[model samples]
Target: MIHVLVTQAGHLEETSKQCCKMSETTSKHTSALCTMQSLHLVLLVVLTIFVYYVSKPHVTEVQPMNRFDVTNVSYTVSMAQPTDSIQRTAVSERTYVMVMSQKRSGSSFMGELFNQNPTVFFMFEPLRSLTSLAMKKTSFSFETAVHNTLNSIFKCELTHVPVSGWVVKKTEVSTCFNAFEMQNNSVLRQICSKYDLTGNQMFLNISSTLCKRRSHFAFKTIRITDLAHLKPFFVNDEFNIKVIHLVRDPRAVMNSRHLLHEENLDFIRRKGTHADEVKDLCQNMKVNIAYGQHIPDWLVGRYKLVRYEDLAEKPFQVTSDIYNYLGWILPQEVNTWILRNTDHDDDKAYSRTRDSRKTAQAWRKTMPFPDVLNIQNKCQDVMKLLGYVQFESRQSMRDAKSSCIPFNGYLNHI
Candidate 1:
């Protein structure tokens, strides 16, 4: 009986030992499972964070406006989505210059004088975009469009520029225009790829950055008709504005316009006769010259008039005078560009390269005597103001040795 009771006790002890071993194995398996689940949760959180940042858009900072007091001008602000928006950075002071001229008056060549300078951020016919937009939108105010586009670009916020696709292709952004050659431009390409962008937006980032880096800002425009239209721009204390009003002989202008067959694009839409066109051109010039002559307090020391004939005659002197007037150094590269461009001949209508002296006088030889007489008759007042002499006869007009531009013209002093 004692042996049987001892056997039962041994069996119970073995059973209890087996139960303890099973409990230890189960606890170990549960702990390993919990650790694997925790690792997976941590990985999921890390992946979510990475995705949030990778998909985020780039942001650029720009300066906010203190005040843009344009009278009777209604400017529109850009309404791009926040994802594509550019924020304002700190405002840095810069010199703003506008090269205002009539088309075919050597404005393209004149603009290049500034465009070649690395120090100057140059824009070509930006208002031409405004002119296009104004045509489509009847509500558009010319003054408003001018101020809006200029204000945005001048401030280095390019998102709001009224740029059309045609302007993009023809102007400085692609192959670039009037200034800042973008043809085969590596910086522009890199910016586009880095931002994963296409079309005009590709230029937006690069242009704004470039604009800020430069000390001087110059734009050439033929859209603004009256000097009084820019009264608001001149008064703004935020900018140090200078105006270079470029004029040319009306006869030469008419001759160039005829070459392009651009009579339809003339500012005067009246009878469309050659005489009427010259009449309209002279009237605009007369008004602007009068304003410059009786300069206002705001425009004093700020407005300058340049004749295409004078610039063509004395490229270096006029350019130097212009740089001096603006308190800027005449870069050696500008001189080199002047040397190369002035002596060469290019058949392209908008070619900057030309024999400038020959070009200035080409109208005399190219235009018929009847056409010359008609222009002279209509633009006599303007010719007198700008120092162009009227020809007595066809023989005198044909005389290459006897020049029509007087040696003692108004531009001689400049």
Candidate 2:
């Protein structure tokens, strides 16, 4: 009887051992399967995000502050000839004011506006690399030359300068930088410097202009990308410049983009100088955003958010505001000049030629679906900050616009 009991006990032990082994194997297998599923799910999510960001169009904020490191210079000057306008060369009393901006953001136009000031003489993107070449200066630092020229132009401390026709006395982006000649003027630098000062300090000790009453000296430039990458050389005297932020709706901006090359990127690629301009404009905007974190706030008010539409609608007021902001006299001549040459009077031309306030909102029809979605996806942060909406479809856009409400108060605050 005792031997029978022992055998039964051994059989029971074997069965229990087999059951425990099966349970352990099942748990291991289930856990392995769950982990595999989790990994696949994670990969799918990562791929989706990557696709969204990559396929989207890029957008950057329209920041107009912190341009032209004016350490010791004023913008007041004297000029009688309209031909002496800033379209020729950038000038200041003692330094150059490099007006850095996107290509078609009207940086040159602003230079023209200041050039026409009775008290200011601003040359358009003067001191360009091509300009240096045309002047036969071997290895010229346009940044340095502008500093020397502005010191002389505004040293007299004059006011209310007159601006007329543009002069080709200078080298332009379009004139020199072209293909087939094996030339590449792709880099246009707008570095402003002043004598008797190091660019390290942000203070502009303008004893010359400060001592003179109603005296101003200034120069203007446009281009801010390469400098952004090389931010280590930021000097208040030579590089710290003020900015005038010119902003419009992304939709309107997109329209202007289309008008620039008929909205055809391919056409621009095949075209002449416009191709470079188009490329430069987009590149600059992207660089500006990437460096947004380092930009200072003083440059904010330095940015007078001028809407192209508002400028056209109230050229007189806008012109006056710009002059006032510059601490210069507002002359009747500028008003007359704007009236005669600008599209302020003609609503039809304004609408047709991309000058109307409503033109920006018109992008719902103009911008292609892919582009529209791309912008919406990539530039939402900036677009929302600027009070623009991402349209999902036609019905949604109409509903939003009809409300007459801007999301971020992003219009003509200047």
TM-score for each predicted model, relative to the true structure: 0.71, 0.44
Compare the candidates by lDDT and give the number of the best one: 1
Candidate 1: where are CA atoms >4 Å away? 1-92, 165-197, 263-275, 407-414
How would you encode candidate 2's per-residue C-alpha lDDT over 1-414 as one tens digit per residue? 434544554555565455555656678766565555555555655665676677678896422112233332433332122223331232223222344554344454445565454443344443333333424555655444434443333432212111110122333333222221111111111112233222211111132233132223444444234343223223333333444555444554555566655443222322434554433444445445433334544343343445544564555777787666655567775666566555432333212133434443545555567766655566566555445556777566655245222432224431
- Supply the TM-score for candidate 1: 0.71
- 234: Cα error in model 1, Å: 1.0
Residue 163 of model 2, lDDT score: 10
lDDT of candidate 2 vs native? 0.42
Q: What is model 1's C-alpha RMSD?
A: 15.4
Error of 1 at 220 (Å): 0.3
lDDT of each: 0.70, 0.42
